[model samples]
Target: MIDLKACPLWLYRLLPFLRWWPNVTAHTFKADSVAALTGALIVLPQAVAFATIAGLPPEYGLYAAMVPAVVAALWGSSWHLVSGPTTAISIVVFAAISPLAEPGSPQFVTLVLTLTFLAGAIQLAMGLARLGGLVNFISHTVIIGFTAGAAILIAASQIKNFFGLDMPRGAHFHEVLIHFGSHLTDIQPWVATVGAATLAAGILARRYLPKLPYMIVAMVVGSVTAAVLNARLGQEATGILTVGALAASFPPLSMPDFSLTAIKQTIFPATIIAVLALTEAVAIARSVATRSDQRIDSNQEFVGQGLSNLAGSFFSGYASSGSFNRSGVNYASGAKTPLAAAMSALFLLLIVLLVAPLAAYLPVPSMAAILFIVAWSLIDFHHIGEIVKRHKRERVVLALTFVGTLVDLEKGIFLGILVSLLFYLYRTSQPSIRELVPDPAELRNPRRKFVAKTPDTATCPQMPILRVEGSIFFGAVEHVQRHFRNVDEADPDKKNLLITARAIGFIDLAGAEMLAKESNRRRKLGGNLYLVGVQPDFCEMLRRSGQVDTVGEDQIFRHKGEALQAIYPRLDNEICRRCTARIFDECHVALPDGTPRAVADQREAEAALARLHAQGATAS
Candidate 1:
């Protein structure tokens, strides 16, 4: 036996399955077998439906669920995430390829294979480069909007099959609606009846028979209804079409086109799919990992998904990603390791071999109805409502993405991402700057608290304390400079500026330069700028940028009290004598010139008493 303990780190990465191989006991094997069987049952109808969405032959969907599932599971980080043909990826594949070639044609299949190969290659490169974090830039709102819009397209594409209309294949979403509306009178009763029955059966099964695979139940119901109608009123009269028997053999080996023209045509689409598929796979893996209390390696998952797609391109599979439904089911069924996902592929192969012939009875309208259900499930109405009702920025992203997707599927997501990033930059460019004053209630307490300045609250005429909350980067340098300039511009007497820098998270070179310049400007105006509670990163940035000496070492302090004590003596003695706002402990006792303020306080009290006496005489 190989000594697993002596294995190098590279071996574990090269064969990720080795990490968990030693933990697989007989009990775990039994558990995995049961989960695998359940997953196989669940993916059967889904694979067929997803293939239909992708505009490929029914058998291709089952083929996708086979090899890709095994490869992803064995090579990936997650134990339960099942990689297969998902609705979003299937719709994307169809949208990207249909414009280039006829749907369901050999040419279309060939282009799809090329796209898959390119996408897989890109994913592998990104994984090796450790760029898995790039997916984080594609916000969750973009995914939601894109998925919802794709779901609409999926339903629209099936209108022809569901109602037996002669609409052109691969029509845009709006064109489909217009055609359906104009051809309302041409709807076939038998086809519509079959579709309606399947839809109702699926809905009921999902609601009442939660434990059963609803798609299978709905397919059985629709097939029986179609058979009854066809038998009663001849096949010619009813005009119902069936999906025909799927090939029962294993997935045949295939090759992707490698011509320069094919690669050029598919490269852009492949990039889109590569990023989208990686996002979907990593998100699903991490989600399942959360439930299992497992730590997920996103880069490893990326590599696994890439390898699976590469394997798929050769084994007659199109682009694929992690299926949340199948992964959730695998976890819920008590899957203990990635073996469950791999075994599920084997189980699916066997199940497909047995049930392949039964597909001859499955009506096209029934398949369309099942797809409609799948489309509806893809929309997260609860989250959509929350976004629309609560988050303004996210709502804008959602609306743009949803509309853009309906117009053009491939570019819509990118537009959404761009808009969201712009919004994020706009926000981060203006950090929160608030003028602060010592809270009267907390002044007596040793830990003097500061609250945002109010119009009624008094502030020192010479020195003003402001808090900066957020990073000070290149984008924010102008905003910070504007705030600094506004301080003395609004009030000439407020020459000394004290910044509470504890809230500042980071400072880049631009920020350091801006601070140094502001300090110089303040000194030239017969005042100074001081920083209190500056973090280590802020200091390091200043030091590295060679602005520390420019800002002056004595001007930066580690604590609020120390900074206050050092800065209080530097204010103009004339301004301190006239100032009524005793905002600090030192301000209450003496002037900046080391002179006693007791005589001034006594004279002010006597003056107030004399004014009251004169007011009483005038009243008499």
Candidate 2:
């Protein structure tokens, strides 16, 4: 306990686990165990499919679920996240390796292992460097759109097996459709029957039998149904297929090819897989964390996922990442710690060792049907509806991501993130700059507070109060300048401009330059520019950027009273003496030159009122 407590503050900062070490308990252990068992059951079929997608042997998928799941959970921030083989990573791996060598060949497997290793290395480096902010670049809109699209693609890919259609292996989306269309007449009715039956049973089990493992139940029903059909119609008459027998064993120790040829071929493909896998893992972790109200550390998650894959590469496993189904099941089952993911791997190893041979009776159509359910569950219908009804831009992003994923798996998510970023930058580049008028109705009683008010010609002429909204960055320079230009263009004779700088979110060099330029321009016209309630960062930027020199130091004021006092002298004496517009305390006194305006004289007051009327000015 003292050793744990003796950790330096900086070390604790770098490795946050030191803070949470004290929270482990018997209750947490009990919760984690149940979640782990549930996760193991969920991953059983998915591991096989994912390994097949990644161009690895059936057992490799199971191996991927073993060590990697535990490693990620042990080091990761999220208690519920279970990292392992995922469809997106699998498809990406297939795409990457297929271009280099034939699928299922030794060369293909070697290249995939190398790619996994490299990806793991990259993720680890990023985590150590605290580059977790990379996740922020992938906008929420992009993730939502991309996941929805990926879910559809998952369903689409299974159509061939579900209908038992003759589509060529590794067919692109367009090619799959064309192949299916050409072979439309060749659909096997018996295979469809088994698939549909399995789908229904799974759906019903999940909806009604909440305690039962739905996927396992559905597989059993489909298998039993297929077996009966095979017996009744004779093996040759009923062409229902099964997954064949699986090899029963623990996660085997494996080797990755370190050959130059393999590295050269695998590096590019590995990068794609790495990025996709990292994204899937982080997104899953974040989703579960959100429901639990947990503080998830992205960098720590990166470290965990990286270590898991690195271990997986040596354990007869292909590339792997987080599984939403397993993670969600884990959370719903009430997992309390990373131990749940660790226990899941342990349970899977035991299950595989005992039940591997039994998998031969499991039908392929049943697996496909189960995947359809998983894919469907991934689609958040309510969130999609919200996106469509509330946010038009996000809806477009969702559609694009979904379509793009259908067309090409690797590029869809990347495209969505790029599009979202562009929209964000566009908004930031043109900040809102508004000319403001004081709430004349609330002036006398500050406690009266503000109501909706607008400016007009009858507004105070001496001070043109304005509000600068949003950040002032390099890209926003032209917009801020144009706003200032338009301010005096409306009425240059007003002579004084008061800027309420509170709404100005942030400022950069370009913003400071524009401010300096505007100040000089206003001074040239004999009008003074005053700033009120400037933010610290904005003021610091002005000082450091040397823009404070261009705009005089005394010119920056903190409040309306100070600004009025400073600009009083700069106003035209002729207009002030003849004017009845007593908009400020300074206006009630003599002119800047100290010549009194005898407004006490009733006739002078009449002339001033008439002049004010002529000028279309109002008194509060």
lDDT of each: 0.93, 0.78
Misplaced by over 4 Å in model 2 are 9-19, 52-55, 99-102, 291-293, 445-457, 573-620
Q: Against the hidden reference, what TM-scores do the models get? A: 0.96, 0.89
Top model number, TM-score: 1
Count clashing pairs, candidate 1.
0
Clash pairs detected, candidate 1:
none
Position 42, candidate 1: lDDT: 94
Shift in Å, residue 584, candidate 1: 1.1
lDDT of 2 by residue, 1-620 (tens): 37867889887755555666566688988888888887888788778877765667777789889988878877778878888888777777876677677777887777778888888888888888898878777776776776677666667667888998866666777777778788878988898889999999999999999788787899899999899888899656767888877888877777888888888877766666777777778888888889999988888888888888888898877778888878999999898777788899999988888888888888778878987887788777888889899998888788887788777767777778777888788888888766554445545443322223254323445556777778889988887778777767887676667777878899989889888988888888888778887888888999999989788778887766666667678778766665655545555566776655454345467887898897775553
Best by lDDT: 1
lDDT, model 2, position 14: 57
Ten contiguous residues with the weakest lDDT in model 2: 444-453
